[model samples]
Target: MHKSYVGRRRKNPARIEMQEGNETPTRDQIESVVSLYNGGELDAAHAATTELIEKFPAASILHNIRGAVNARKGNHEGAAKDFQNAIDTNPAFPDAYNNLGVALKKLGRQQEAIENYRRAVSIKPDYAEAYFNMANALRDLGRQEDAVSNYKQTLRIAPKHNGARNNLGVLLNKLQRYEEAVSQFSAVLLANPNFADAYNNLGLALKNIGREEEALASFAKATEVKPDYAEAHYNKGSYLFDLGRRQEAEASYAEALRLKPDFAEAFRSLGAVKRYEKDDPQIPYIKSLLDRNDISDNDRMHLNYALGKVSEDLGQHREAFTHYQNANFLRKKFLNYTPDLERRLFRMVRESFEDVERIKNIYRAPAEPFRKTPIFVVGMPRSGTSLTEHILASHSQIYGAGELTTFGMAVNSVWSGGEVTAEQLQTIREKYLADMNRRDVAEPFITDKMHLNYRWIGFICMALPGAKIVHIKRRSIASCWSIFKYYFSDFGNGYAYDLDDLGEYYASYMDLMKFWEERFPGAIYNFSYESLTENQEEETRKLLDYLGLDLEQSCIDFHETKRAVATISSMQVRRKLYKGSSEEWRKYENFLKPLIARLGED
Candidate 1:
């Protein structure tokens, strides 16, 4: 949130130093005001600049100096007017325009600020500060790609611009370009080793790329550098929570809340790990936040979700439903979910593989066996995909590779209108296996528990014939209810926020799985979650047999297996199996009539 070129120590102050015109004020008179401004005597600088401006009314430097003083003093409105006056005196003044942009941006006029920044950069193309300011404005206006271009331009002009680099890294992370983000952050930290934000951003990017241990170290470094960084603490807590370190996660969250008491996301994350009792103090605090009008919809959404979690734990089913309903209602505003578009995509997927014989013909086994094989645990969200992966990964020779996007990236690379050529199929196979081979795991089998990989079963069969696909099944009501009640960090699960959308999406998923089953009978191992809970030994034996592996005692002792699980079910998978989860939805059955009706046939 640093302003454009304010506190930077640079030689040759082009923006502040006035030219010696024939009729302008003397150099000594100008220096008197500029010296006060530069010396941090804002009151003296403002008073002296205003007095001199009256004598030399055409002096743009006097106005610019006054604007800089006002900006430093936090009077953006006055600073903007002063910068405007400077621009009027000298219309080609890029500095004044840039300064005006900063002032206007502080006043919440991002579009106008961007316009001023554009004008400044146009007047003087080498104005790196203007470009940096424009990039910040573009990000505020939600023009992320444009912001990135401007940020790159700023760095190109001023390679030592750590602020621009740090912001660019953050924006890249938001765009999910994690590796590029890591590079930017790393470069920033190389020059400025004490840059806390860079360390924090690097941690985020590393986490996204499955470098959890490195990410944790980066987060720790960020906190060590900046002790009061609440967001860093919150992020560390989230990573810990995903790793099933509930106590440590809770402690981190507590530190974050201590630093920033109104941190709604931290509260929501704390609620995720905390099992609430009747008199939990956090309950009233979260409820109090809901009554405050100043809170944002995003904050309100998190607060409501947190309240919902605590209420549900306390058996206040109806109250929890109300909070969840409100939370989802707020959440839906930020998501773009079109049922028809989803339906069309599903239809195309079905049509692409409609020629079952052609699809089967294209399927080819590798010339040599892969030293490492993948076990894809695919299914709907909250349908025990994580649990299945945890169980399978408990084996001595299997490792859990959580929710990898390598296959999806390969699919998107060469997939043309849902069709794939034989060469393209090979390319997909090579790309996917190349990524897998690059992984550091020594295990012969790795479990990829990216639940939505259910969508690409046909491609998986063709490209990775050696891969085992396990389709974990749960009762429809239980699964949909589980999805709707909780929040998914991934935006792809947009359908979960609405009951009707959830039902329709589930129905399509079931239908697609049926089509796959019809085409590739006996290919997918359909594991029943309920059955696994009821008869753990028999069902697990069947699962292991499908993968051609001998039953291990560790599989039965899955709860005791130690590994990092980064799913919502991270905590759940660490405990012993229990039945009756499917029946929990019955408590909210009356309120879920719409969902039930939509899922009637399922």
Candidate 2:
């Protein structure tokens, strides 16, 4: 009889575990309820659980099972209440607490869910499930570092925790720890062997670090693992797009949208693909989605922005500007509107007055110290840096090194280390120059267009004493508005989130420019984007003459050059120079009233 009972118990682990724990209602009772709930007999499960609860009023197990069923039916508040009842009846039931936390987290109560997770972990120190739930709560709260620690702890207790590992990788990637993230995602594949999202993310991480081939292999593997994975198709398309494989890229984008009709990212990519001549097919869909009550305001805002791009491409500049303005306005209503960044901007007139004496001390005419020179274009994004670069790049003897990360890397090494020997500095300077030596593009002079290099102008001058810097400037409202409307994949432009933050950043830029002008006179040149577009020929000639490059027809036919452009303005630069967008901010006068007041008063 004992042996028969033992065999029967081995066949039902949940029953034995529940019996051992002395919980009311059998494990069989809960399993029966779960089966009914999953098999569309949810009403039966509710009736069974209610009867069990009446027989044993403090039956936490019945309450927990009922809560899971309620969660399935989208009754989040009901599930939360039932889970709370379970915890209240049996305070030591860790699984019930975890379930309650999940329900609360689904409702976006991150802080409260975290408290429940903490309680579950406290009651059951080895509760790996609770740890995972805690990590999720922390991630929802935007406390990513804390979430990572919790996730790592879960995996430490259960090495085969694929879900935890994959989530950890996603968080690390968002934090820009690409290599570390790659390792975690790879480990998840090793454990689960079929995680498509993990494989897709691994590809992105590898690509970010310049391992393009391996990234492509990972993405291919993701599609192989799950042919229906729209994200993998999108990933493949974006990669192909970057590689300049137009046909294959478009096909991939189309495939992704076919698999998932509401894939907005895919729509954005389609718009980008057709942007050269404005062959957009996604605008109609976006327009239809713009008035969707089911979608978010934020989604609608991005849709408007997409419609704006379509109009902009179709030569409807005014309509495009209006849509972009609306998008920026709608996006501002979000909580993370914008954050502060430490980029420098130039304000010349007051800077001249304040730095009059300092400039007198620092200013000295160049003695023609070096026959060879490289001009550095330093400024904010969309601040005429690219235009300045294209003009110089068109020069007969100058090469355009578009957006070189070298100078910033060197300066970061200096700042992060806080000390550098003369030999070290010389090595860095050589690296900077060697960076300009691209494949078959040798020239007497090159343009180092590290836009953010404006902050490190002092270090830049110290390293290359003969280098000339062009600080590209744009109007404050226009620049901030442009940034806000631009969606970013990285963290550098946090000011895109908020109007106040944009204003604060503009103020910071002004201060830095003032400091640099005082500290390094004649080291930086200012070229406002507005002014440059207004007087293109004169500015082009003046800029080229400064670099000692003689005038050439190539400079005039800059738009005709078929050079590779990686910036978002790549397609726009391929056309003739025009002043179509000279007064883009005028239409948004009502929207910018506050911003204008702020800038005007200052």
Candidate 3:
């Protein structure tokens, strides 16, 4: 009889655990109620528990069981009340407090939930479940470091706690600690080989660190383990899209949407891959989704941007402008931007590098050992940086390390009181190069087309004297119009959202470039976008000669280059040069009066 009871207790862990140190209810009674609740018979369990509580009104365990049933039924308010009743009846009951926290968390009362969890752990110091619950609440509250600590504590107490381990991995990924995140996810997979979500998360961590092949293998493994995983397919599509495999990306996104019909993000990504030439059928289907009242704000933003792209492709200039305007307006609501903040930064940069004497004095310091000369393509956004990069990357000796932020980040890290030392310069240079090498760049002349590096020209000259700076210039109207029409993911491009802000920012950029040119004469090579388009051969030869490289016909035939381009101009760069992009802005000249007024062109 004793052996049979122990076997039954093994199958009903929750009931046996709850009955410990409690005498009101026999083990059989507790098992009966808990079994009904655990088996998905919520209504029947609730009725039985209500009768049990009436018979044993002061039974704290029965109240906790009823609260668990209420929570499962999504009656969080009722659950909180029942859990509080249990706690009040037996103030030392740790399970009652823990269950109450779960109910409060479901109600979005995270602070209250955290307090209850603390009470649970205080009553029972080794309560691994309460620690895990508290960690989740902390993560939701954006206290990531505290969440990480609590999750670690949870795992220490309960070594096989899979939930804590997986969540810790996710929080680490958000914090950009990809290596640690990979380890956590790997441990999860080792414990349970069929854990599909862990495999997907491990792939994301691997991708963040530039291990593309390994990441893809992990994503493939997830799909193999869970054949119907829509999110894994969507992630695969996103990775392919980033690598410029548009056809494969389209197929992956389509499969994701087929598996989950209401997947709005997959639909938006599919539209991006379509490239929306004249009269694409997907345009109308995307527009039809806007009529659905349940569409999310993010989905609406993507749809508006897609509509703008399709309209632009079809040569509906006015309609395209309207959609672009709506999209920017919607996105701007979520960003913290002010024109004055940018203007002030520009002012500070100019003043910092104002004196040529001070710059020369810094140059007089000992120079670092000369390394390979890197070509920096610096200019305003949409000023033909991508085109110039594509042209230069066609050279066998040059590798295009697209739009590196390493120099900019290094400058931000070391800038102090307008003074820099030779040692500091060398440190910055070595750090920047180390970052580039990690990206697998080994060419003698790599092009860092980080357009905003225009602001860091003085630092670049001091740190890397061998580096060649190419300044790409575009006409003001065309540049501003292009910026306004596009959606930039970088928060630093906040000025692009508004016409007046864009104009002012462009003026600041021009002013700073003039300062750099004056301070470092003959250091910058100027290239005009219009000139490049009009005289591809003449300009390409001049650019090649400037870089001291013999002319390669491949530079002129850049369209045939197979390298991946991860820019807004990715599509344009894949085709031969067209002449109309410069003139297209004139069609919307009337609506761009604010921009024209700000540029002092009127």
Candidate 4:
């Protein structure tokens, strides 16, 4: 990851097209609909689009208009269907492809969504707007380098494209090119003064470079311009939290949550406040919210995840498992797919990691540019990477960016575009390094706890000579069984139907780790999960010192920090370090005994 304000673009810049033909049977009707849409009469536009389609069923233009209207009205599924209808009606229509991609992305069909976006640009090379949409989709698909190039492409074609420029600024920030990101954000402000998000993000880039006072001013202007902006408020609150401005930070965090209640992060932040008994009014906020069924589905899903924490903390494993399972269910429900998609995704991730050396080809040249590297905490999902991150993040110098996919994204960008050569690999590696520089943490360190990064560690080190790998180790049974019960929402295998896959996957991961350690001695830091649980302080101190940094008292008390953690262990990590987690597998020992035998654990 580059830095706090990097890797993402300015919010939702691309707009769907609404066409009106001067010569047609429904020419007057089309003009009237266009007038209504231009005047923000979305309902009237929708009706007209429907009527026009009824009268002229072959018109892609009418379908596109309907899709735009549906999109504006927050009917993304409807908008996506209409856009797809437009595409089906006119297969070569680039605008429809772009709009369909945006709608599909909003609807959480990311892979297909990105493919549509890519097709849009391919069909219309000079369509800067299509490139902008493509860039956004690429960023979401975790293909940051391509997004960077596309953002640049939009700006190259249209320099005054404030949106693309702003997005480039964000990507630069992720690339760890703070000065460049700042300049880009400043450039957006120059072009359009009321871009509140740009100012807020500018402040992030500024704060990253240690420009505290200037960062504060930018954040304040962002909030002043858009008081309801949750991110701006959150940014200011984070700054205040750092400065120990407890009351001010609490108010800001509260305001942020007030505006975006479905934000799992704000709730997690509030939970952290409660954990520390920070000078903030902390109720059973998340729990109390869950008691009400009137809340939105998004809120319910997050509540279930948070509830798992409370249950776990209260020694309610059964309740914890149920809520986590529900959370896992709900997060996946956002993706509208048949049963086949899961199998496809499994193959996709598996196949990518199959050839270790081929995967190595994804890393850009870092021999000269990227000397200092981050601590890569790689292990199974529940194998204590979060805990390791939290422990290490407790250090005064190393701020936890939290489970980022910067390295994987950069690597994936290489193969994701399909199998490549020596030249393509080198080009992508440089492009991604440039992207990484935008995220910040270009120098000494950053924690990219993308646990899956474990599979790519060998390839990563080969690409970037100075790269450091921390192999977070956990007992085989403990890791596998923990994953089986809690369930994961994002990737496949968390809901794997068979025990054989889980066991084999576990064995494969361990074997991979062993091979890497043997091949590249001193490249991996093997920290046993059980050992760390027994001696967090000593081990954490050792880990920090190994990175050549002095440990702060604060690092030892990482639980006291009030930051938003997005992992399954967010709730657990907020509380003081405890030993019970080490005993977690015991509860399900009877259930996992056969699985243990599969691991050949006699």
**lDDT computed for candidate 2:** 0.69
List TM-score per model, in order: 0.77, 0.67, 0.72, 0.64
**Which regions of candidate 1 are displaced past 4 Å?**
1-158, 164-186, 205-217, 356-366, 416-418
Model 2 residue 140 CA deviation (Å) reads 2.2
Report residue 113 deviation for candidate 1 (angstroms).
12
* Best-fitting candidate, scored by lDDT: 1
Output the TM-score of candidate 2. 0.67
- Report the C-alpha lDDT of model 4 over 101-135, residue by residue, as the tens digit: 88888888877887887788788888887788778
Model 3, position 369: C-alpha lDDT score: 48
Please list the C-alpha lDDT of all candidates, in the order they appear. 0.85, 0.69, 0.80, 0.70
When summed lDDT is taken over every stretch of 10 residues in candidate 1, the lowest stretch is 1-10
User: Of 1 and 4, which scores higher on TM-score?
Assistant: 1
lDDT of 3 at 95: 85
Ranking by TM-score: 1, 3, 2, 4
Clashing pairs in 1: none
* Superposition TM-score, candidate 3 onto the true structure: 0.72
In candidate 3, the residue pairs with backbone N, CA or C atoms under 3 Å apart (3 or more residues apart, or in different chains) clash, namely none
- Candidate 3 achieves a global lDDT of 0.80
Ranking by lDDT: 1, 3, 4, 2
Please give the TM-score that candidate 4 achieves against the real structure.
0.64
List, residue by residue over 1-602, the lDDT tens digit for candidate 3.
Answer: 00000000012212114754444677688789989998989899999999989988888888889988888788989999999998888899888888888889988999999999999999999999889889989988978889999999999999888778888888787665677999999998899898888888887777766678898898899889999988888887777766667798889888888888767667656766786766666777878886678887766766777788778778788888888787787767656678877777777777777775766676543455434568999998888999999999999989887766678767776775466566667777877877655554566788899899998888888777768999999888888998998877656788888787788888888888888888889999999999989889999999999999988999999988877565767667777887778887888888898898888764
Local accuracy of candidate 1 as per-residue lDDT tens digits, 245-339: 88999998999999999998888888888899988887888888999999999899989889989989999999999999899888888776668
